[model samples]
Target: MKLQKLTGVWIPLVSIFFGLLAGAIIMLLFGYNPVAGYIALWNGAFEEPYYTGETIRLITPYILSGLAVAFAFRTGLLNIGVEGQVLVGWLASVWIGLAFNLPMIIHLPLAIIAAIIAGGLWGFIPGYLKAKFHVHEVIITIMMNYVALYSVNAIIRNVLTDGSERTEHVAETASLKVEWLTQLMPNSNVHAGIILAVGAALFYWYFIEKTKYGFELKAVGYNSYASEYAGMSVKRNIMVSMAISGGFAGLAGAMEGIGNFGYMTLNNGFTNIGFDGIAIALLGGNTAVGVVMAAGLFGVLKNGALNMPLSAGVPHELVDIITALIIFFVAASYMIILFREKLTNIFNNVKTKLQKGRGK
Candidate 1:
């Protein structure tokens, strides 16, 4: 029993260690100094104030997006629509930020609220369809992603800015400038979005841990038929879950738009933030603390990947290999769990046989 419990906790640690070992092996195979490459990557991620801020910046979006995916996972809904929700959220935030002439406090919150609403509505479409017509959410979400992409581009080009493929730069009043972010790294676009992400994480934890609604969602997730028989509205829960999940995804997009870029431009196409969130959620096991930590890990990797090629002569592609290996290890953790169990059983058997022989 103790061995089983220990295995539960140590499995994740072992997976991470093995993943790093695999990454090092790959680096050595490629004729690179693995230690130096890893050092360079770590230093690039943390050496300077600017790089630290960049890590936070990357983490901010990951936190929100990861929460989005995790939330749906908890509710038994696979929210593949987060990509579309993010795009719509970006469009809504920039459109409102550029068009409105409100004060900073009002404008910023309004833009965020609008983005959340837009994302929620986008999510609600799939939820309602699933509940009412039994349409597969995966197919709907995939189609909606492309729809949102094209729709946003069209709005930016035709209606919003006269075929410019971008919105006017948001007014200065609407930027998410915070003193700490600015003081920590001058000229960096990092801002209060980090606070927003943290707040969202806390809120999600509280919502799931301390609310009747949360219980309903979980019950529905485990078994909709049972939940319905037990007096919970499964349909309502589904709609609510999707809305809340998409709202988080929307906030991720809004952070990138208002806090980082201060405008919506079609230069980068869709960022795949929603899809990345799926990976984050999977790696984190759909838990609150796990999601936050996974997001931070991803942030560090991304920040360091940028500097690896230039500094260590280790191609940036190595980072991709590292990340892929990490994900593979995570996905295959059952093997580690099995190995641990077998070892524990063998040890116990040996201990028992020795004790019996001594008594005889």
Candidate 2:
């Protein structure tokens, strides 16, 4: 019985442990020292100050994007357009940052808000279509992503000074910089954005777990017909959920603009963070806390991969293989459950005999 209980608690951890062991085996096959590779990974991610800053930098955008995807998942929506929403948010922030001549305090926040609004509005289009015209969110969001991509590129090319493909650097006062911290960690871009991401996560947790509207959204996600029968307005909940999801994604773009890059340049390809957010959401299990934890784990993995190559001659791509294995094991937890059940039955029989002996 004790063994069975122990297995139940440790199954997931053991799965991850085995996954890492398998990853180490692959490293050995490649003539790399697995220990050295992992050590480097650890040192790169946390042992040094700069690397620790880098981990936080990587985590900043990931947290918001994870929240975006996780929020949609809670309501049973697969918002594939986080990429597009984030792009539009980026464009909006850059545009506002460059076009406005307001004071630093006002201008910076206004730009950030503009990004959020743009992201929300962009998301609203799909939500509205889904609610009214019965259009599928997946298809619409996918198409909209392309629209945001090209449209942003065009705008950047046409409106900026000398037709440059980038916006003017945000005003010094409007920037999200801490000169003291920057001096402490020279060349690092970590800033107040981490606070924003944390705040957003906390707000999301409260909204979903404590609010009536959150209940409506979850009810609608579970069953639209049942939600409507329960007197909840399903369509409204759907629209609200998408809008909120988009806003969170927009905040992600704003963080990139204000905290990381400082100005927007249209990238011709997909922003990989959007896709990464999907993995983060899945790993986090569609909960607010889960998303943050998952993002941290990914942050470690990303930083660690950079270190592995330097220390052990292991390719950074090996980290991807490890991540894949973790996901696979998590998905196949049913086997763990089966093994636990059999062990539990055996333990119960043993316990029953022990009880009989005590009674006699």
Candidate 3:
């Protein structure tokens, strides 16, 4: 069991190391100093207190988005519409925050709940279609992404516009900002959302690892037909799984609306956070701890990329290339395993021959 757990951890770490090595090789080929570039990247992400806080702020939404993808993957579903869910959730939360004048205790939670419900409803459509009509979730979700983008834009234009591309700022009571935290890390956007993100990760770990429903979910994932034979309602599980998955993504949007941005603005394109969550989920092996770690790594990369060109004379696109390489290596993990096994066999044979010669 210990060895298996170690392997799980090591595989992703090894993939990351190889990805960096590939990036370094590319830098060398381009006459860039890989060491200096990495040093600058590290400094940009962690050298200052403000940068550290900024990284954490970025990580907050990433953690939830990653959890959203990971949860669906674990349940044998692919939630490709997390981007749409996030957009709608952002609008829902921001609308509630602006519309209400309640106290902090009530207003804050209400906005969050609205976001979750909006995202859940969005997910439910595809889930229901898949369950009732055997429709492919991927296609429905892709279509929903456009629907969400256009619908939210229309709604913003018609109802929420304040003579600007964004809605009015959320009320102070609905905000997640902690004045002390911001003061502590000057110029950083740290907020209570980080706490919520950590809490959500813990809750997800407990729910998926220690509960009976979690087992049912996993059982269905492993084999839906067998789970149905054993009396589990696969359809119900699918819907619930998607709802929960979407709720996580919605929470990510809530963090942006109520914590980071304090408003929803017109987006000409997807925020890309939800799409990045797919990479996070893959790099994380769809595990809670892995997701958190992967999110942090990605946060650092994104935050530091801005400084790469100025500080190290390396193009910021190098980070994107590195990320793509990491994903490639992760996707080709079976090759890594086969290579390891072959090396292990070679070492064993060599050891056996040396021992026989010594004994003779």
> What TM-score fits each model?
0.90, 0.88, 0.92
Model 3: per-residue lDDT, tens digit, 1-360? Answer: 897688778878988999999999999999999999999899889889898888889999999999999998999999999999989888999999999899999999999999989988888889888888989888998899899998998888888984477888899999988888888888888888999898889988998999999889888888999999999999999888888888898889898999889998888999998999999999998899999999999999999887899899999999999999998988788577788889999999999999999999
- Comparison by lDDT, 2 against 3, better one: 3
Task: Give candidate 3 regions above 4 Å deviation.
Answer: 1-3, 335-360
lDDT tens digits, residues 1-360, model 1? 797556544555566678789989988998998898888888878888888888888899899899999999998999998988998888888888888899888999999898889988899889889888889888998899899998888888887787786677887777777786789887667789899899999999889868999889988998999999999988889889988998998988898878888888774456978888998887777778778888998888888888888888998888878877777888788676778789999999999999999999
lDDT order of candidates, top first: 3, 1, 2
- Model 1 residue 310 CA deviation (Å) reads 1.3
Evaluate residue 84 in candidate 2 and report its C-alpha lDDT on the 0 to 100 scale: 90
Best by lDDT, which number? 3
Candidate-wise lDDT, in order: 0.85, 0.83, 0.90
Stretches of model 2 off by over 4 angstroms after superposition = 1-15, 334-360
Ten-residue region with minimum lDDT total, candidate 1: 4-13
